[model samples]
Target: MKQKISLITTGGTIASKETKNGMLSSGALSGDELAALCKLPDDIEIRIVDFMKVPSMHMNFHRMLALRDAINKELEDPDVTGVVVTHGTDSLEETAYFLDIVTEDKRPIVVTGSQRSPQEVGTDVYSNLRNSIYAAANPLLENGGVVVVFNERIYSAKYVKKVHASNLQGFESFGYGYLGIIDNDVVSIYQKPLHREFFSVQNEIPRVDIIKCHTGADGLFIDASVAVGAKGIILEGVGRGQVTPQMVSSIQKALDSGTNIVITTSAEEGKVHPAYDYEGSAFDLKERGVILGADYDSKKARIKLAVLLACKNKIKSSDFKY
Candidate 1:
C-alpha cells in the first residue's frame, strides 16, 4: 500500500524565486515544483493543499486557525497517514508551537522551511522538505502534536526556537534539544515530545500582545496593549524574568483590567523562575497575578495564553499539565 501524505504549501523561501527586482515569495512553486525537486518515492502518494504562498511574518492567528482547520480536515481522512506544512522561517516556530497546543494528537504533522531561497545557492528547501516528508510518512510521531524539521533536525514544536537570524541551523529546541534527525538516505529517532494539550477552536481568537522588557520600559506598551482590547500579555523579561520597575506598575494595571499576564525569560534557553525579590522581579509579578511561563519562550507563551483565553471557561492550568 502507498504511504498517503497531505502536504500543505504556505509560501516561504522554499517556494520563492529570484525576480529582476528582488527575490519574491509567492506562487513560484507548489505541487509540481516540489514533486520535481524531491522526486519522492514511487510508493508515497502525496496530496498537496495549497493554502497560501506568502511569507511567514504575514501569518497571524486567523491564518494559523485556517491552517489548523486544514490539518484537522486532512486527519479526517483515514487514508492520510500524516500532514506536512511548508512555512516561512520568520514566524515558523511560533506557528508550530501554536499548532502543538491546539491540534489534537491524532497523526503526525511536520513543519519545515528553508533559510535560503531556491534561487540562492546552498538552499536547504528541497532537502528539508524531503526529510519532512520522511518524518510525516513514517510513524515516528504518529501520535502527534507538531514537529519542526530543518537542517535534518527534528524538534518538538513546544520547545523549538529559531535561534539564528540566517543559518541552516536556525532552529534550537532549547533544553530538550532535537527529538530526531532525518536525511535523504537515513532516518533516526532519539526521543519524542511526551505531552500534548488541545483546545477547541473559538469563533474569535483573542488578541494577545507581547512586550519585551528592557531597562527603561515605562509600561506604555502594556497600557496600550490593554487599551487595544488585548485579552492577554506576554512579558519577555530580563534575567530570571525580571522587569523594570516602571513595567511592574503597568503590568499590575493590566492584571487589574482582567488581562492575563504571563512572564517569560528573554534569554531563550531557561525556565522562568521566581528568584528575585525586587519591585520588578518574577516574585513581585507573580504576587501581582502574573503567571510564570515556565520553560516556554515569549512567542509560545503568547500562543498558550491566547488559546487559554479563547477557551477560558473550558481550560485550566492543569489542562496544560506542565
Candidate 2:
C-alpha cells in the first residue's frame, strides 16, 4: 500500500500571483491546484487540506493554534503517515518553532514555502512542494518533530531561519546547525532536538512584543510597551545579549512592574551568555529576574513567551520548563 501524506496550505509566496498593478495577490491558487503541479510516485497517496489563505506575515498566534488543531485532526486518522505545511517564508520559522514546542505527535510535521512566486520563470514552488511531499512520505522523518525543508536543506523547526531576502535558498539553521539534509532521495540523520513536552494554553491569549537594542537606544519603546499592557517582551540585544544603559533601566522597570522579560541575542547564531561582565547591560537586566531566551530569535522567543503566559495562571514558574 502507498504511504499517505496530508498537505495543509497556509498561503505564502507559493500561492501568490502577480497582479496588473505589480503587486502580489495571495490566495491565487487552492490546495488542490498546487498539488496538481507536483509529480508524485505511485507509492505516495497525497491529500490536500486548505487551512488558511493568507500570507505568513499576517499569521498570528490564533492562526497558529488553528493550524495545530488542523494537524491534530488529520493525525487522528489512522491512514495518515505524515503532514506538510505550505507557509509563507516571512514567519515560517516562528510557526515551525511553535509547532515543535507544542505538538505532541511524533510524526513528521514538515513546513515548506517558496521565495519566488509561481509566475516567475525559475519559480521553485514545484520542486519545493515535490520535495516536501517526498520528505513527508519518508519513514525516517517520523521522529524528527517539526522541521522546515527548503533550498535543498533540512533544518530543525527551532533553529531554521530565513536569512536571504529573495533568494531561493533563503532558509538556514543558525548556531546549532541543521538536523540533516536530503540528497538523492535519501534523508540522512544527524542531531536530534531534545523532546521536551511543553504545555499549551487552553483559554486566554497572551500578547508579546519584541524590542531591539541598537546604539544610543533609549527606554521609550520599553515604556510604551508596558503602558500598552503587553504581557511579555522579548529583548533582541547585541552580541551575547547586551543592551544600552537606558534600555537596561527600562527592562528593570518593566520586570519590577510585573511584566515578564526574555533576553535573546540579535546575532544569527550562538546562545546568550549571561556570565559576561556583571557591570554590563546584560548582567544588570538579568539581575531583575529577566529570563534568558538562550538561542531563540526574537520572534520565536516571543511566541514561546506568549504560550507560556497564556498558561501562567495554571502553571507556576517552577512548572515552566522550556
Candidate 3:
C-alpha cells in the first residue's frame, strides 16, 4: 500500500510571492498553488489542507490550538502515515514547540518553511517542502514529537531556533545539533529525543511574557507585564541565569502577586543553575521563588509556561525540567 501523507499549508515564505513593490508578500499562494509548483513524489499519496494564509507573526494561541485540532482531525484516518505543516520561518520554532507539547498523536508532525520566496533565484522552497513530505512519511520519525525540516536538516522542535534572518539554513538546534537530515529525497536519522512531553490545554492560553536582562536593566517590563495581568513571565538572564540587581525587586513583586516567573539563560547552550548567591544570581532568584528554566530560550520558555498555566493542576518547577 502507498504511504499517505497529510500536507497542511498555513502560509509562509514558501507560499509567498514577490509583490509589485519589490517586497515579498507572505502567503500569497494557496495550498494547491504551492503544491502545484513543487515536484512531489509519485510513489506516495498526499492530502492537502489549505488551513490558513498569514505570516508567522500573526499566529496566536487560538490559531495554534486550531491547527492542532486540524492535525488531530486528519490523524483520525488510520491510513494516514504522518503529517507535514508548511509555516513561516519567522516564528516557526515557536509553533513547532507549541505543537510538540499539545499534539496528541505519536506519528511524525513535520513542520517546514523556506527562507526565500518561490520566485527568488536559488530558492529552497521546492527542496524543503519536498523533503518535509518525505520526512513526514518516514516511520523512523514516529513518536519523536514535532520536528522542523529546513535546509535538508531535521531538528527537534524542542531545541530548534531560527538563527538567521534570510539564509536558507535559517533554523538550528545548537548544543544538541539536528536530529537528522534529508539528502536526495531520502530521510536519514542520526538520533531521537529520549523523551516527549504532552500537556492537556483545558483553558485558554494565558498571558506569558519574556523579559530580557541586560546591564543596568530594571524591572519595568516585569512591572508592566504584571500590571496587565500576565500569568507567567520568563526572564532571559545572562550567564547561568543572573539578572541585574535592579530587576530583583520587581521579580519578587511579580512572584508575590502569584505570577509564574522562570529564569532562563540567554546563552545558546547550558541550563540555568543556581551556582552563585549574589543579589540577582540564579541561587538568589530560586530562593525568591523563581523556577529555573533549564536550557530553554525565552520564546520557548514562554510557550511552555503558557501551556502549563492553561493545563490542569498547579504549576510546579519540576514541570519545566524536561
On lDDT, the leading prediction is 3
lDDT of 3 by residue, 92-182 (tens): 9999999999997999999999999998899999999999999999999999999999999999999999999988889898999999999
Q: After the best TM-score superposition of candidate 2, give how far the Cα of residue 157 lies from its true spot, in angstroms.
A: 0.7
Ordered by TM-score, highest first, the candidates read 3, 1, 2
Candidate 2: tens digits of C-alpha lDDT, residues 163-251: 99899889887667777777765677677777655556686667789999898898899999999999898889888878887677788
**Superposed Cα RMSD, model 1:** 1.8
Candidate lDDT values, in order: 0.83, 0.81, 0.94
Per-model tally of clashing residue pairs: 0, 0, 0
TM-score of 2: 0.93
User: Using TM-score as the measure, which candidate wins?
Assistant: 3
Rate residue 66 of model 1 by lDDT: 91
User: Whole-model lDDT for model 3 versus the true structure?
Assistant: 0.94
Cα lDDT of candidate 2 equals 0.81
* CA RMSD of all predictions: 1.8, 2.1, 0.7
Query: Clashes in model 1: which pairs?
Result: none
